[model samples]
Target chain A: MSDTPMEAAPFAEKAPDAPVRVLSEGLASWLLVSPLAILLAIFLVIPISVIVTVSFWGYNEWDFYPDFTFENYEYLLTSAVTFDTYVKTFSYVLMAWAFTAAIGFAVAYFLAFHVRSTVWQVALFLVCTVPFWTSNIIRMISWIPFLGRNGLANEVLLQAGLIETPLEFLLFSDFAVVLAFVHLYTLFMVVPIFNSMMRIDRSLIEAARDNGASPFQILTNVILPLSKPGLMIGSIFVVTLVMGDFITVRFMSGSQSASVGRIIQNEIALLQYPAAAASAVVLLITVLIMIAVMLRLVDIRKEL
Target chain B: MDRTETKGVSRRALLKGTAAVGAAAVGSGVIGAPMIWAQNIKDVTLRQFGTGVSNLNEVAEKVKEDLGFTLQMTALDSDSVTQRAATQPKSFDIADIEYWICKKVWGAGNLQAMDVSRIENYDKIVGIFKSGKLTPESTIAQGTAPHSVGFVPEPGARAFADEQTNWMTLIPTIYNADTLGIRPDLIGRPINNWSELLNPEFKGKASILDISAIGIMDMAMVCESMGEIQYGDKGNMTQEEIDKTIAIFIEAKRAGQFRAFWKSFDESVNLMASGEVVIQSMWSPAITAVKSKGIPCVYQPLEEGYRSWGGGLGLSANLSGLELDAAYEYINWYLSGWVGGFLMRQGYYSAVPETSKLFMSENEWGYWFEGKEATEVITNPQGSPMAQVGEVRDGGSFEERMGRVACWNAVMDENKYMVRKWNEFIAA
Candidate 1:
């Protein structure tokens, strides 16, 4: 109550001057950020706007044309297939996010807290990214030799008398698809979280310990709250990537799986340009909504 | 990547090529006229784009050797080939593409009518591209028969004729009767009908191609054989027909009947070679490739017949004058024996059967065309033994296979709807 009265007294005195001060402050910051805004306008904004314009155009088998129509959007909304595809794509996002976040947090926690020497921590962290040096297609393909029908995993399982028949789900299955997603995107999650974790003050842990807080209690109460920003940033990277990916799912699932990107690709291949553009626009909006929700959950700008 | 094999007339060197040809024309007024034409032709280059099945570097080298002009080949997948053919006219001088794709590209007017009179072996070309029949008794099968679009009624005509004429759209190159390929040693049973592909017994041991335009045809064949859905025309399926066909496959896919769907030749080869799949919708050369690895693979003929697709060369609308003459020269040389014989060794039938027969040995002709047991081992164009001494070709004679073509790969009037349904199947 004492703090509220003091805050209200200062705010009441400064009310007349507040609007002018905030306007000038915002303008200065906006000027500082203008270059990046202009860059985005040229590359990202212009291309996406073009796609948006095309989304409302009419098309047939031969070609697309300049005419306003809502048929593409109507077709998408009415079809059960589109909704099912969205759900499947969402499932992929959830699976990838879960695996990537858990694995990324553990790895980053080990590097930031467990390792004593800074040089060794850097070396070990770099070692975690060794797989990134090769082509993604190569890395995904390399799984086939190990997870195939008569591959190493099956042969080992069979030799151990685990089962009579080989495991069919080892490759070209949902399991394989999710495995590849985690293998590819874990680094995306790890880096941001690691940066945030490294910037965390060490005295907080000491302070908790001196107050008779147990290690687990300290972890839950102190470290977890402080790491929210890193976790949020990492989750955003993983969620957007998994939601947009078609290649990893396509290759790993052997064309048996579907993504919104794959649908857009198939339409483009058949020269259904307007339909592809419409799907792209819808996907863009859906991803933006997801990011907005993530932002609302954690004030990322303030944390950064 | 494109390989340009030549006397070095690159894409930008066309003007120089015409100048060289003009110089040769002037030199042709001298004693050694044929020598001058041959020498100057080396400076001319023609760019050709097609599917990898036909646009071999070997064919380009052979053209350079025989026709005295450079032939640059760019190999792309079927859809990309169609896209380039329809939208990019100046990008290529010749398009070796499928007939169904021809329907799409023809409307764009990117290709011009090729003269049947210019192709020397035109009459000797197969009846399928001329009369729409392999023999007198042969009824033209369903789908876009090459003969339907092979000719135009007039010179520089953009529209395809219903019947044959002197003004041709494409000079036929290679075609085949495609069917399911099976690893016979793995199955240890005679699998004959198309219905066997989705049989519960082979559950998790079967696959189909993932290409929608072609894959749907195979699905229609399977659905008909299984007595699930009946279609009046498999190639140009109605909207209801497509729905039923896709639904049936989606059910089968959900039941785990498929090991994996293949999108490329190498993937099909890998599936068969690794013993991951026992039966699948397959291309001819993929079977040959598997057999070349000493694996027991067969392009098995089913009781329901085969789904066929054919590809040929179409001239770009941009060609005229001496460059056009050089292209005509290349087409004539293509129909001549050696290239046909080379392609025949790789499991594709030549357009001019009689000329190709001249290039093959008696044993090869008997084994490949006549379906006789091989007295000697048969080698592919790469000189690798594809079949052992006593083995007969899997689907029997060319007459036996070609006579039974059930349908051709197609792009229907309802192509957009069909593609949407196809995507729905994949998503399902």
Candidate 2:
């Protein structure tokens, strides 16, 4: 202990006087972080501030002007069509998140617990991630061939004599949108959960088994409780992604379904910038509340 | 430590401060270097839609050589182009929009009206361009009055009449006739009319281009020929006439006559090539694609005339002073013989008839440029005329086509309702 204290003394003694050291350290830290701080100021803070400011202004038909009014916000709150878009968006996100999370957890569990070799585990995970490397537009378009009226799925079923007519419900419907959401975002959930699962203690599971605990008991009492943080993290990723997605819903749902993101897109297209900004602000607040609720549930601070 | 070391530190600090200042000066110099070089140049950007046909690169080079001006060109889809025109008016100096879309954007007061007097080539414009009710005063307003002047019409270079080719409001730039493109190998027979699309035998094998106006027009033509409605008038179509047309489409869709709806030109071509669709409503370029592949396909002429649309260039509302003067010069050059000849070779008929005649043979001009016959044979790239045989009528004399103009820049104000109704029809 004395040797250890002596070893640290030279470096400590060479350090500047207390107040000078503190000042120098603070200056060095500021120098290192200044680029990032500038980037955040320009890209994130400034844009968001502008959006908030614009939300309160009135549209002059020809241009956006700096007339302070609550007309945009009032329009959002009063319009039934706009309010319904929010409700529809929330429900779609919830369904999509739940579907992705359920399947993702299962896939992650199989990869972590059942796979015997590291090579096979890595290979399987890579297979799951393969579709993600392609452009999202290409992936969405690939669905057209398989889901068209005279598509491969229908052809297969018809050949097997399973059905006489083509299934119209297969494509350009709510089912297709949800299916695409799950397909695209499941890996986003799985990767985080699998990482957390890899960090779980093997010895604890072995000890539970040695004490004659059943497989179900071990899973319910030991594994699931420990995996809550990962589950919450996965849910956060899926929920936020599904909530903000407009392209997938638009392409898959054809014209029947409307999401909050799509409404924002429509407003922007129509040059209704203030209304779009107000809707965006509302969506941001809603997503923040959701994240806070999720944080409370999982105590993500502990995991961090 | 040593008192000597402590005394030396202040000297080192002075050197480090100088180095830091030098490095920052160099860093900022590197960042600011390109801006200094770019300061002397002024950028004039134009955005248009339709790929492989617009010849934007060639046009840009021509402008640079002739007018001592540089042009930055971007290509986008029709919808995206119109959306950008409405949203970011300052981002583009000129835009090429379809005739129907021109009405919507023009109505929105996003486009500037042209000064016909300044456009030197304005007088040489074919009768179709001159005859329309779209005057400079009507199109060019100071504020939110939808008046736009820079129009370059294409393929369907006819006037808007109650019955035939009523697109007079647009300055026709590039126009292609809409015809039935059929795969001879698959159909094993020649297709001559619109009735074949609804034939029960071709169920799930037939397709139509999913543009609202074109599709609706085709349906109306079919219904008119079938005696489902009176044949002569289309512009003043009653609600009952429109419903009858809608019903034909709905019935066809219910019978699985359509495999899928295509949102792009490429998608439609791909579907045709794969044998997924044997017959479809298509433009000339699509026929060119099938012929290029050596697949036996033909653009069959129906008994009724082809439904067609054209795109024209429009000015922005914000142009003024020197920019406006430059805009007039550009528009004049665009209407000159060179652009007209260029467009003609790309399968588009130009508004400047003399310019078109300069490049095409008298016979070819008679068939296409003059619309002398209802259907005429025109040579493909390989020098063999892709057999385009049908009812040949002079695409009525330029005056007749322009004079009887029926519709100008027709855009449904209730597009949301239209989209919803269209979706319901598709779903059903």
For model 1 chain B, give the 10-residue run with minimal summed lDDT: B27-36
TM-score of chain B of 2: 0.70
Worst 10-residue lDDT window for candidate 1 chain A reads: A16-25
DockQ, per model, reads 0.54, 0.07
Docking class of 1: medium
Over B59-163, each residue of candidate 2 has an lDDT whose tens digit, in order, gives 777665544446667787565666777677878777777766665555455566554555555556644345333234322111111122223232222222232
Query: What are the iRMS values of all candidates?
Result: 1.3, 5.8
| Number of the top TM-score candidate | 1
In model 1, which runs have C-alpha deviations exceeding 4 angstroms? A1-38, B1-40
| Residue range B1-428, candidate 1, lDDT tens digits | 24564434575476655665664454333212243254456667899999999999999886665555788999998878877887789999999999989987787888989877767788889899999999999998988888888889997677888888889988899999999999999999998899999999889889999888899999989999999987888989999999889888889989999888888889999989999899999999999888878899989999999999888998999998778888887777778777888888888899987878878988888888889999898988788998789999988999999999999888788887888888888888
The sequence of per-residue lDDT tens digits that candidate 1 reaches over residues A145-253 is 7898999999999999997999999899989999999999899988988888898899989999999999889878987778889999999999998888878888788
